[model samples]
Target: MFLVLQLAIIVLSFIAHEHEAIAAYVPDYSSLVFPIHKHTDAAKPLYSVEIMTAYVNMQYLHANFLIDVDAPFIWHDCIVQWNIYPGSCPPDKLCTSPVSCDEYQCTDVRTSYSYQKPYCSPPKNESISPGWGYCSCSVNVVDPVTGSCGQAKLNYWDDFTVNVSNGKNVLTGVYGVYPYAACAPSSAFQSFPANVTGVMALSSSPYALPAHLLEPLENVIGLCLPSTLSTSGVLFYGNSPYYLLPQKDVDVRSYLSYTPLIKHPDSFGYFIDVNNIVIKKRSISIPANATTKISTLDPYAILRTDIYNRVIRRFSMVTKRIPPAKPVPPFGLCFSTQSGLRVPDIDFSLPEGKKWTMSAANSIKQVTKDVACLALVDGGATSEPAIVIGSFQMEDNFLVFDLENSTFGFSSSLLRKQTSCSNFNFTLVES
Candidate 1:
């Protein structure tokens, strides 16, 4: 079920009223924090970053900022129906394939292009008509739902600024917004304004540094996503203390754990070294020289059925001491407990003797009052065979992606503590 949810990407947008620039961005000792909220309607424990857009009306949008290591630029949903110019085409005539424009009685308007070109002024002698100029070039937009690609008319917002605040300190950055077909359900769409910035595309966009991270200004950022529904977390720029526990905060610079971030040349997904799995103190044997691949720490933990089977087999072996109940349809291992049962701890052994242990709360799910099912799911036969540590496993942990240093850090979150994260001080140590 989690795997299916990962494939169904639904893009969303929001509208806000326009506002004046607060003040020049100052990098002082003060930190800017944005509250992370959970989408209750989402199938999985999805998180969103609340941001303000500098559209005509000053709209607010929730940007889904994934810890995607491979993304090159930030992406956002723009207003396609507005009928705006996309700038002039390149000298090479590398515009997207031309589409029919009845108003101009011409089919030369390219609807999609390999990359968005810089906005250029129309030639003085050039005649302008509705959808008849070089500015009509299109952009390649991906449908979050079906993973299909289509063309959406392009328009550029020179004053586009996304405002991120934690009620005290606010941070803002500019972004290029592009419109795509609404992928969210109709009911959800009605809740948002008719004209809103649906998405704040970040990570990988054609930029030397990620613009969303206040690129060229502040290169460091940290994310602490809470796993529980009752609590909220913080996403901040620059360095601060390790958010080990909300109630008991620790300086990340003082005692933070470090791991080398493995890079995949062809992808933007963050990958890490995982040696083996240990269930109930017993190390499960993996095939020798099995070409262990780095599993992406994605929002969804998707394990290939083959690997899921191996992990479950070892899990079953350790739990053989308990009475087995009927197995759940989707989940392979499940049990019926009256007084509750003790599920063994599962650990993923990393290099340098470092181990990430999964607590029972993260490894088990209460499907019913009497029946509990394993939270892990099969990736099916065709899914990526590599292991993916999804958001479920990352709950209750402060995940820091230090792009400036090219490293990743993880520590326990301040569980259930609700406080302004801006007040906390963090040490900015460049890796």
Candidate 2:
């Protein structure tokens, strides 16, 4: 772990009843919450987005999903066959019904880059179920990394809860949000962690997870990614007043700096403007209109080859005095931590003179007891997205994505407040 950070555990109270309806048991006012867990994979990072969902084989499922802000629609690893099966719907799915091809929900898929129009099942095969045969919605489920896709059909999920927090000490689990729409892929292109199933999409698309869970409150997401596997991060699905407990007086939003979020017509990820990169007293000038995307799927921040070389060159010069350690596999540079080493913070200079500073904890990664390396990697060379901010740098940072106003808010590091993202109080309050 970079610095002192701890994320509270998000307890999931899943309802296993035969049929649970969300509309009957949900409160009008309350911010939905989830605890984010970092998995044990060191080679390729896998952050767990916990959930209980429904599909083909399983009656009930306790699954792990990736929190991908870059994806449009939510999809899972379930097999979907072309021909219709008589008894495909599980009991958990009985709470909600499948969407119809003639419905507006299916038409909305036409507007999405992540989905495809499902050819209406030839008139010969009478409709067995709403989404199965007659004009079902076919999809191209986007993988977070390669951008390649897998096949799936439009599906609705039930059994996901409607737990909410007061942004303080109380988190109450309402009945649940039934019929939340998602997709069922034939096979997930990306590898999963153990029981991992799919992605918790928080993209800008109207079909994302947040879109299905839209409430009467502010359209925003407050997220804190944890740095350590021993702890977990937190998510707030609504506007804030997101409080870090024990020190409830300190609201995480108070420290955020705002920047306009840029949208790509072809992509579903969030993009930001970066004037240049700065290290120590040296300022490395980048293209005037250079932009970068923040990704939860990328384990390490990636810079263009040229930009990465410049950063490593500058860093090497800055700490040239320290003894160098043996090179790690992916990391080009390493320093002997046993002899004591210090790294200068790297800054992604934003417009309006605002800088998204990367603290040493985020700037460097401790690969081994005596070895430490820069937490950045090279993404070949591309000007379209000169940088891709990764999960390693996002740990313990309270990020607020305001979709309503098209803005991105960030808290540099929660450790600076003497608390971590784990400070949220998930304990239930008695009515």
Candidate with the greatest lDDT versus the true structure: 2
Supply every candidate's count of residue pairs whose N, Cα or C atoms clash at under 3 angstroms: 37, 3
The numbered model that scores best in TM-score is: 2
User: Which regions of candidate 1 are displaced past 4 Å?
Assistant: 1-26, 29-31, 55-72, 80-132, 135-137, 143-150, 153-209, 212-218, 242-249, 252-255, 285-300, 322-325, 412-431
Q: lDDT of all the models against the reference?
A: 0.47, 0.72
Candidate 2, residue 339: lDDT: 76
Model 1 lDDT per residue over 1-431, tens place:
88766555432111111112224434333344555554444333455555543333355434443233333332344332223345553222112222223323122212211222234222122223455454332334333222344444433322223433322334353333332111222232222223322333333233212443453234555666566555555666555433433434445444346566665544444556667778977786534332222221334456667778888898888777666677775677887777668988788777787766776755776778788877777878656435667666666555666666766676533332342222332323321
Judge candidate 1 against the unseen true structure and give its global Cα lDDT, from 0 to 1: 0.47
Alpha-carbon deviation at 205 in model 1, angstroms: 5.3
Candidate 2 runs further than 4 Å off: 1-30, 52-62, 77-104, 114-135, 145-148, 157-159, 173-175, 178-180, 183-190
